[model samples]
Target chain A: MIAHAIFFYTFSIIAVVSAIMVTASKNTVHSVFFLILDFISISCLFIMIGAEFLGMIMLIVYVGAVAVLFLFVVMMLNVAQQKNQWFAGQQSSRHIPVGLIISTLIFFEIIIVIGGWKYKPEIFDINNSISQASISNTHSLGQILYTDYIHVFQISGMILLVAMVGAIVLTFRQRSGVKRQSYIKQISRERAEGVEVLEVQSNKGVKLDD
Target chain B: MEYLSAVFQEVYKILFLLVPVLVSVAMIVWLDRRVWAFVQKRQGPNVVGPFGLLQSLADALKYIFKEIIIPSSSNKVIFILAPIVTMTLALIAWAVIPFSATQVLADINVGILYLFAVSSLGVYGIIMGGWASNSKYPFLGAIRSAAQMVSYEVSIGVIIINVLLCVGSLNLNDIVIAQKNMWFVIPLFPMFVIFFISALAETNRPPFDLPEAEAELVAGYQTEYSGMMYAMFWLGEYANILLMCAMGAILFLGGWMSPIDVYPFTLVPGAIWLILKILLLFILFALVKAIVPRYRYDQLMRLGWKVFLPLSLTWVVLTASYLFYFNLLPVN
Candidate 1:
């Protein structure tokens, strides 16, 4: 119980700090750094929920690749921009009370809805039957993922396929001057004895430096 | 009250035991050098103590008193925090690894999963350290390291899936015990080899060590780190090598079990055998690094993505069939 509480509080604190930093930064590059922190905290929250695999995937895919792409792009674009331009209009201070009022109202509404509602704990008789109806709960997830969720997975796969194809199309422009290695040429060659008769002579006609 | 006090006493003893194990990683580096020195026909570190037993310690002391230079342009917080992140994450992975039946710090049900998670997080430190340095070489090295780590992690996961197919449990101890009659290396030998190789690459050891290749990227991702910070990365790398070897022992060599204890041949305790296997693996790793030239960056990527990834993917399917058809798994 204590561990769970700690996990929740830790992630909550991290999320809020990163979120605040995202807007508070005068420089856009610094904002992106905060954004990376936000993604990391969300991934940690996934781990606390027992989705270890998903948590790892999130870190490897989102943080490792996507956020990196963002940082690289942001760094490139933000290089010529002035830092003062970002914070000039945002820190007017007149909008603070209005923002606070709206946020507090939303917070109260969520608190009332969650705290005022209570559900009795009743044992579902279908727990064993439904569980047995499938294989291991984990295996059932995999099965459903392939069978029932097959179309959804397929569509997602297709979207990624399209994205990959688009990337190839966009990036495969010809470089007229530069040459790149051809894998076929490299793979088809074997080391041969072409060096036995080759003789190298210093240019005899060239004048030697005294 | 008595039991509570006893728990506190046990924790203290555990702390005392950890001191040696932690120090042993540094000693392994010295032993690793000596082994590789013999392999390569050279004399190893021999000045500090007999066989240079205290050489690594002496180096650590030297690094301690050295000045920690911070570049004026560097992000002070992340630059300082990055190495600590790497060291702590590396150490935390060791927490779930059992030295003996009762010696693990936290032998949770999902031990292997915990290891994978912690290792993935360790990359964050390298990335942040590289970026915070505000240097070109460090930046490029960090980017390359992050991408390479992720690529190999996929292959590692695939190889692990093959093992999980055979063992049918996630716990490290269970995986070890499942090899009572026969080690996984005997049946799933290919996966073991693949996992071991991927582990070396994951730890950024030689051939796969383009991230820190001095000739290419200067000192690579850690070009700007110095003193304790640089020491932390060095210690973390060695510590990670130990963790990988320990995991290999746990997953494939029957963790702490002597091969002959239940197999009608050997009589050594499982713990001693485990240590022996880990040290031997470290020596082998160092030997490979000592002799081989580092691979080019593109070549490393090609081997990881084009070669090991496909090999591991195929093994996953093959192992799954073997388990299901042979009735090894308890699941239907």
Candidate 2:
């Protein structure tokens, strides 16, 4: 229990600091790196808390895929040189109070959710079948995910599929006069079409263009 | 006192696993060079020791003694952190690799997922190093590598799912045990091929080594690194390759299981069987390096996306249906 607490605190602190650094860092690339660090630390916390399946998936999805895409975009855009104007821009100052209000509201919402869970523990007990100790984490999770929440799980997957198709549709383009390889046509070509048996073939070679 | 002893025991086990792995990395490097040389009819690295056994060792010493030149314009912190991250991540995935039924570090329920997650994170090292160097070639190499790895990982995931359907478990030991009757390579031959090819692409081996195409990218992300730093990248790369080979062995070749169940084969320990399997796969990897030509970037992307992805996905469906039809799926 002591070791768990020590690790929990360490990971949480790192996650929190890195979360702050995600926005506080000057360079956009650094911000993305910090974002990745935040994801990793949070995943570490998840793994430490015995939700190993979720933790590993979280690492795979967030740190591996999402953060990599974020870095790719940041690197491609060459935005690291741009000075952050969050604090200094007079023109953007008007939005600060609005941002502060929204952030505080969201913050309180998280606090209330955590506090509710803490105060009313029966809310979790209602679905306690999912956390049976007899089975492994992967088994239990799979059981619940495939059975109790099958529709929702599949619907979310379909939504992701639709989003991917939409993104491809949005970006895809066809350019004119582009020569594309037709594998079938190239492979099916016969020599008979190019080679003709003519009496004056040697002399007619000079008039091949005709 | 008990806690201290437990900690010491864990450390001892880690060292037991890691020291051999590091030594094997050196040996594998030498083997790779020799394989390449044998293909070209030359005696590769034979002067350092007996049959050039200490060539990699001498290279390590030279790297240790060389100067580490950090480019003045580079992002110093990330540049240094990149190779460390690479080497560390490469090594840590070995924690879950089962040499035998009893010889694994963490026999976690989600061991396969942990390996996948760790291996997926390996791209960050190259990306970070390339971007940190602030050079065009390294940056280009990093982007290519990032794209290549990510593209190949999808097919690898689908291929792994085919295996998981057969075993119905994620634990590496469980995977091996489930293969007692027959190896996965026999039934899931197509998926195995896709997995092997994707592993090659994932580890950035030739014909998929567009990231470090010497004629173009000039050592890729390692262009700016020098001394021990560059050596770390080299070590991490070979380690990653070995890890991929081990993964291939575990997933398709029945891991540490002997080829024959007879008395002679059974007399040999499981660890030896596993090592021999890994060495066999590594030799294949080296042979592919020598024989195959490098792929163009677009061709690599096309192969990963257009060909392997759909094929692996189809195989997953087919495997699931076949298992379901025959009631062969392992029930928890």
Candidate 3:
């Protein structure tokens, strides 16, 4: 229990610091790196809390794929030289109050949610049965995900698929006069098509035009 | 006192696993050079020790003694952090690799996912190093490598699903045990092949090593690194290659399992069998480097996306359907 607490505190501290640094950093590339660090520390917390699958998936998806794409865009755009100017311009100063209002509202909503949270008595029964089964964390999660929430799970997957297709559709373009490799045509070339057996080929240069 | 003892024991076990791995990385580097030399009909690194056994050791010493010149314009902090991240992440994935039934560090339920997650994070090291260098070639190499790894990872994920469809468990040990009757290579041969090729691409080996194409990128992301820093990248690359080889052995070749069930084969320990399997796969990786030419960037992307992605996706469907139809899926 002590070890768990120690780890939880360490990871949460790192995560919070990195989260702040994500926006506070001047360099865009540094911001992305801090964002990655934020994701990693949060995932470490998740793993420490016994949700290994979710933690690992979070690392794979967020830190691995999304953050990499973020880094790629940042690097390619050469945006690291741009200084953070949220408070610099007189024009930008007007939005600060609005941002503060919105952020405070979010903070209150999270506080209310945590303050009102309570475990139902039946939840204990469900937990008892799960522990009795002695199944692995992944197995138990799969059981619930596939059975109790199958439709929701599948709908989320479908939504992702649609989003992917939409992204592809949005970006895809066709170029005119571009030569593309046709593997079938290349592989199916025949010797007979190019060669002709002519009786008097040598005399008139095989009547080349004909 | 008891807590201290437990912590010490854990550290000891980690060292037990890590020391051999680092040593083996050194040895594998020598083997890679020797194989390349054999292919080119020349003696490779044979002067230092017997058959050039100490060549990698000697290289390590040279790297240790050399100067680490950080580029003046580079992002100094991240520039230093990159190779450390690379080498550390490469080594940590070994924590979950099971040498035998009982020889795992953390027999976590989601071991395979952990491995996947760690390996996927590997691109950051290169990207950090490249972007931090503040040079065009390294930056280009970093982008190329990141795209290549991410593209290949999609297919690798789908291919792993095919294996999971058979084993129905994410635990690496459970995966090996599920193959007691027959190795996954027999039934999922196509997936195995795609996985091997994707592993090659993931580790940035030839012919997928367009990231470090010498004729173009001049050592890729390592262009600005020198001395121990450059050596760290080299060590991390070979370690990642070994990790991939070990993954192949465990996933397809039935890791640590004796090929034959006879008395003599069974007499040898499981760790030895696992090592031999990894060595065999590593040799194939080295041989591929010698025999195949490097791929163009466009061709590499095309192969990963158009060819392997759809193929692996189809195989996943087939494997799932077949397992369902026959009721062969393991019920965990």
Candidate 4:
């Protein structure tokens, strides 16, 4: 219980700090980094909720891959570095108070919603399974995925498949003069049956070892 | 007062573990250097403190006192946070890793998943460090790392699933205990190899060290980092390597269990065996890094996506079959 509390408070602090920094930070890179921290906190929250699978997935997807991707894009663009290249107009500054007010209102609304809701965590304790229930979360998840959520699963899969196809299409660039590897032709290479060992004969008649 | 005491205790334990790791990192660095020296026919840091034991420490101290030069154009906040994230995540992953019986921070049921999560978080350091550098090479390096991590992560997951199907638990302790009779290495050799290789690629160790390949990327994502900032990356990297090797030992070599028998062998503690196994794997990794050349960018992607992914996925299917046929996995 103590461990849980420590983990909770630590991650919550991280989340709040990082979230504030994400908006307040001047540098876009800093903002993106704080976003990564926010994702981490959310992942910790998942773990605290006894959703280890979700936590792991969140880390693997968000921290390992997506956040990195964001950082890479940001770095490649060098938006922060481009600050000197462009003048900081008063346009954004003028809207700051209103943006802050709206954002804070929404944030407080979320806090209220969460604080108002209460449920017995023990009631949904995954460990408190009946003997007939699945062994682990993975087992239970797989069961639901294949049975109760089958259609939803299929639809999600389809969407991901489409996204994959779309990504391929977007990235595919055919330059007029560039050569591409012919995988089919390469795979079809046949070794001839009349494979005579070619004796390399220099004027001195040097035999190469097989 | 009680809470304060608990916190203090936690801090003390953390410090104790951390000091050893930091020292071990130094030792590993020294050992690896010496090995590389022999391989290359050159004297390594033998001149410093009788076989250069203090060299890594000296270098660390040197970095400690050096100036932290944040580039004017760079994001100071993220740049600073990047290395900390990297180092912190690496250290935290050690929490679930059991060295011996009853010697773990928290023996969580989902220890394996915790490992995955923490290791995954490690990429952020590289990404943030790169992005905050405000350099083109670093940016490209970060891009490569992101793509590589994602591609290899899928394979790693599949391999982990294969292990899980056989072990029937996500708990690291349970998995290790399952291997008490016979090491999982022999039966699950293929998965072991796949996992090890994926781990190598995941941690960005050579020949999978494309993210920081010097010839092309020019120190890659950490181009701008110098002094302790750079040292943090180095330390974080070596720590990750040890963590991976420790994990591999736990997963395959019966963890702290001696190879001999069911009855506890009085000859050596399991922790020693675990450490020795880890050391051996660490040496193998370091050796491979020293000898093997880095893979081309395209080749890396092809191998991770086209080859390793399919192989691991197929193994997952095979494992499922083996479990079903043998009725090993717990099922309704």
Candidate 5:
């Protein structure tokens, strides 16, 4: 138990620090790297807490796919080296007070919620919940995901499908200037259509364009 | 004190495992060169040790002694951090990889998913390196790598879902154990092939190696990297290739299980069998590299998005429904 608590504190500290660095970093690329570190540390926390499947999934989804996408966009745009000037512009300075006020409100709300919440001893009692030792986290997740929450699962799938189609529709374009090979057209051409035999071409130069 | 001792024991186990893996990776480099040379009818490195067995060691020594160059315009911090990230991610993924029934360092439930996630995240290394170089070729190479990895990753994910459907488990051990009667390759041959090809693309192996195309990109993302930094990418790439091969073996070829599992076959240990399978897959990877030509950029994208995406998606649907219809899915 002591070891677990030690590891939890260590990983959480790393996670929190990195999460702060993500926004505080001057370079956009460094921000992405900090975001990755944050994800990794949080995933470590997840793994330590026994939700190994969810932890690994979080790593794969956030660090692997999403973070790489962020890195790709940042690099492609060539904007990583820009100096981060917070409240540099006169107009930008006007929003600083509003941002601070909102953040303080959120901080107070979180504090209040935590302070007011009461933890019942029964919540920690294992006898009331499913036996964790008998089944892996993934097994239980699958059981509930497919059987009880099947509709929600299907809806999420639909949402992903819609997002994919929308992305393709938005970015896909056909240009008239570009020349592309049409394999069907090339393969379908017949000798009669492609070649013309003229009797007068033996004595005189053939009029190619005609 | 007891917990401290336990942690030390784990660290010791890790060191031992790491030693063998590091040695194997070195040997794999030498083997790849020799095999490729043999295929091309040329002599490879032969002066180091007997039969050039220590060529990779010599190369490592040379790299260690060489000067590490930092490009003047490059992002100095990220340029160094990129390879470290690459190497660390490559090594950490092995934590959940099972060599046998009990050889895994961490027998997590989502072992396969962890591997997938780590492999997918590999793109960040290339992107970071390329971007930090602040050069045209590396940037282009990084973009190519990012797109290629992302495209292939989608199919690989779907293919893994197909395998998981048959096994009904995400645990690597369970996936292997479920194949006791018949390896998945026999039933899911097309998925096996598709997964293998996708793995090749994911690892940026030849035929799909447009990211680091030598003739065009001039070392691609590694353009500005030198000495030890460059060597780290080499180590990470081979490690990833080996991991992919191990994954292929575990998923489709029944991992450590003997092929026939009768008489003489059952006499051997499971770990040895797993090693043999990995070696075979490595040979296949090398052979393909030697034999195939590099793919054009558009052709590679077409193969991934057009050919593989639909095929793997269709297979996923077919696999799920077939398992349901025949009631052949493994019970949890």
Candidate 6:
């Protein structure tokens, strides 16, 4: 229990600090790196808490794939040179108070929800307690994911498929001047298309231009 | 007192495992070079220690003595951190990899996923290196690597899911034990091929090593690195390759188990079999590097997205249906 508490605190602190750095960093590239760190630390926390499958998935999907995508775009666009203007702009002062108020409200709302949950823990599972001693985390997750939430799982997959198609359609382009290899045309080429028996009859008068 | 002893024991185990792993990295590097050289009809590193046994140690010493040059324009912190991240991730992934039924650093329940996750994160080192270098070529190389790894990861994920369907457990030991009857490669031959190919691409090995394509990118993300820093990348990369080979062994080749369960084969310990399998896989990797030509960029993308994606996805469906039909599906 002591070891668990120590690990939880360490990872949570790292996660929080890195999450802050993700937004607070000046360089966009640095921000992306911080984002990755945040994901990693949070995943570490998840693993420590026994949701090993979820932790690994979070690391794979978010830190590994998504954050790398963010880094790729940031490097490609060369946005690291952009001076952070969050505090520099004179007009930013007007919106600062508004931001503060909104953030505070959200913070209180979270605290209230946590407090209520702490007082009435049964609100979370009034009906079913899914976790069991016999099955491993992966096994139980698979059971619930593929059985009771099967429709939701399928729908989420369809959503991803649609999003993929939509992204392809949006970004895909065709250029007229570019020369591309046509495998079909190359494979289908025939000797009759270019060679002729009467070709040398009159080299100059063979109407080569035609 | 008991807690202190347990902690000490854990540390001892870690050190015990890590030293051999580090040494194996050296051997693998030497072996890879020798194998590649042999394929091309040449002798490789014959002078180091009577047939190049000490070549890796010599190289390590040279790297240690060399100067680490941090490019002035590069982000100093990240440039250093990148290689460390790569090496750390590579080493940590082994914590979950089972050498035998009993030998492992951590016998986690989600061992396969943990491996998958670590392998996927391998791209960050390249990306971070490329971006931190602040050079055009390295940046380009980093982007290519990032995209390549991400694309291959999708197909790899699908392939692993197909394997898990057969084993019914995510534990590496369980996967290997389940294969006692028959290796997964025999039944899931196509998926095995896809997984191997994907692993090659994931590790940025030859034919798919566009990130470091010397003809174009000029060493890719390692263009700016020097001395020990560069050596670290080399070590990390070979470590990753070995890890992938181990992964292949455990997932499909019955891991540490002998090929035939009878007689002489069974007399040998499981760890020896695992080592043999890894060596065989490494030789195959080297052979591919020597024999296969580098793929064109567009063709690589076409293979990953158009060809592999659909093929692996179809196999996943087929595997599931077959399992369900035969009532062979593992009930949790």
Residue lDDT tens for model 6, A126-190: 23525676778777777788998999999999999999999999999998999988867988999
lDDT of 2 by residue, B213-316 (tens): 99999989989999999999999999999999999999999898998788989989998999998999999999999999999888799999999999998888
> lDDT tens string, model 5, B105-150?
8887788898898898888888889888999999999999999999
Clashes of 4: 0
lDDT of 5: 0.88
**Steric clashes per prediction:** 2, 0, 0, 0, 0, 0
lDDT assessment of candidate 1 = 0.79
Backbone clash tally (model 2): 0
**Model 5 spans > 4 angstroms off:** A78-87, A94-131, A183-210
Candidate 6: segments with Cα more than 4 A from true spot: A79-81, A84-87, A90-109, A126-128, A187-210
lDDT of 1 by residue, B223-294 (tens): 999887899998888888898998888888888888676544455566688899898788778888888888
Candidate achieving the largest TM-score = 2
Residue A59 CA displacement from its true place in model 4, Å: 2.2
What does the lDDT read for residue A97 in candidate 1?
A: 97
DockQ of each: 0.24, 0.85, 0.80, 0.49, 0.75, 0.84
Worst 10 residues of 4 chain A by lDDT: A125-134
Candidate 3, A1-210: lDDT as tens digits = 999899899999999999999988778888899999999999999888777788989999999899999988887764633443444546777888999999999999987666555534443356743444478777887888899889999999999999999999999999899998886887898989877787884557655776
Q: Model 2 off-target regions past 4 Å? A: A84-88, A94-98, A185-210
What TM-score number comes out for model 3?
0.93
> Which has the greatest DockQ?
2
Colliding pairs, model 5 = none
If both were scored by TM-score, which would come out higher, candidate 1 or candidate 3?
3
Which of the two candidates, 3 or 5, achieves a greater TM-score against the reference?
A: 3
Ranking 3 against 5 by DockQ, winner: 3
lDDT of 5 at A92: 63
